[model samples]
Target: MQITLIAIGKTDRAELEELISIYAKRLQHYIKFEFRIIPDIKNSKNLSEAQQKEKEGELILAQLQPTDTLILLDEKGKQYTSMDFADFLQKKMNSGIKNLVLVIGGPYGFSEAVYAECSGKISLSKMTFSHQMVRLFLVEQIYRGFTILRNEPYHHQ
Candidate 1:
């Protein structure tokens, strides 16, 4: 199945972008993957938190296709071990999903509308992380998941 990672805003850090790119390239050996970045909203300084979330939610929802299975990366979501995450990926692939869309929302997190549209939510850790860093973490974990699935040396038990 194809996997798409959708994140709000751009990564300005050259180091983070380079590392994310490295894992993204490695992931291509396993399955179809796409990393989509939605440009930050204009005039966000004047918008309220709820207003910002609503606007961002619209952009996030617009990226979805009817066949896509949306999942959000949320702090309050389910947490899993590396091996368990690999199993989760295996199950999604086994279920024959056309596309697995994982989203990392803007700083304030997702709006209620966005939450309602998702199939599930996953948490990388209980502690909060910067939005840009989360992008790198997600891509790397996804690459690691595939390696674990294939019993590759990249992931050690």
Candidate 2:
């Protein structure tokens, strides 16, 4: 199955963008991967946290297909080890999912509506990282997961 990473806004930092692109390119060898960046909301400074999330949620929802399995990268979501994440991915593919969409929400997090629409959630770490950093981390983990599945030397026990 194909995998799509839906994140809000572009990566402003060149280093982070380059690193994200490196991992993303590496991932293409194993699976169909796409990183969908939703532009930041206009005049976001004037909006409340809830309102921003609501608008971002609308944009995020629009990128999804009816057959896609939506998974949010959330702070409160389940945290899996590299190997376990590979298994999670394997299970999804085995189940015959068409498109697996993983979302990284905006600064204030997701709205109640977005949460309700997701099939599952995954947390990369307990400590918080910048949204830009989260994009890189997620892509690297996906690459690592695939490497582990292939019994590559990239991941060590």
Candidate 3:
């Protein structure tokens, strides 16, 4: 199965982008992976929080295929260990899903519509990180999960 990570906005920090890029490249060795950055909404300063989420949700939904399984990176979602996350990916592959999309919403988070559209949600941690940092964290976790699945030395217990 192919894994796609879509995050709202760009990473301004070069360090964070470089790290995320490295993990993204490593992920390609395990499976088909795509890291997509959805451009931030223009003139968003004039919009309400709910309105911004709605606009971002539209863009996100447009990038998806009908067959794709959507997952949100949400704070309120379930938290899994590295091993469990590996198992989750394995099960998705075993189920023959064509694509698994993990989305990191904008600053205000996902809309009600987006929430309703997703198949599931996952939380990286209880604490919050910058949007740019979240991208790096998610990619590293994905790489670690794949390594754990293969019994590689990359991940430690």
Candidate 4:
């Protein structure tokens, strides 16, 4: 199955971008993975939090196809261990899913519409993290999960 990560805003930090790229490249060896950035909304300063999320949600939803399984990266979502996450991925692939779309929402988080459209949610950790940092962390974890599944030496228990 193809795995796509859709996140709002660009990664402005060069170091973080480089790290995300490294993991993304490594992930290509195991599964079809793509990182698509949804540009930040213009004149966001004037919009209310709800309004911003609504606008961003529109763009996020637009990127999806009918058959894609949408999953949101939400703080209040289910948390999984590294091995468990690998198993989750394995199950999705086994089910013959065409694409698994994981989304990271904007600053104020997702809109009600986006929440309703998602099939599930996942949390990397209980601790808060910058949206840009989450991109790197998620990619690295995905790469690690694949390596663990293949019994590679990249991931240590």
lDDT of each prediction vs. the true structure?
0.96, 0.96, 0.95, 0.95
Write the residue-wise lDDT of candidate 2 on 24-65 in tens digits: 999999999999999999999999999999999999999988
**Cα displacement (Å) at residue 72, model 4:** 0.4
Scored by lDDT, the top model is 1
Q: Once superposed on the true structure, which residue ranges of model 3 sit more than 4 Å away at CA?
A: none
Candidate 3 has a TM-score of 0.98
Cα RMSD for candidates in order: 0.5, 0.6, 0.7, 0.6
TM match of model 4 to true structure? 0.98
- The alpha-carbon lDDT assigned to residue 122 of candidate 4 equals 99
Model 1 C-alpha lDDT per residue in residues 1-157, reported as the tens digit of each score? 9999999999999999999999999999999999999999999999999999999999999999989999999999999899999999999999999999999999999999999999999999999999999999999999999999999998877
What's model 2's lDDT at 56? 98
Model 2 spans with C-alpha error above 4 angstroms: none
Per-model clash counts, in order, read 0, 0, 0, 0
lDDT of candidate 3 over 30-80, digit per residue (tens): 999999999999999999999999999999999999999999999999999
Locate the minimum summed-lDDT window of 10 residues in model 1.
148-157
Where model 1 places Cα greater than 4 Å from the true spot, the runs are none
Measured against the true structure, the TM-scores of the candidates, in listed sequence, are 0.99, 0.98, 0.98, 0.98
Model 4, range 35-154, lDDT digits (tens) per residue? 999999999999999999999999999999999999999999999999999888888989998999999999999999999999999999999999999999999988988988899998
**Candidate 4 backbone collisions, by pair:** none
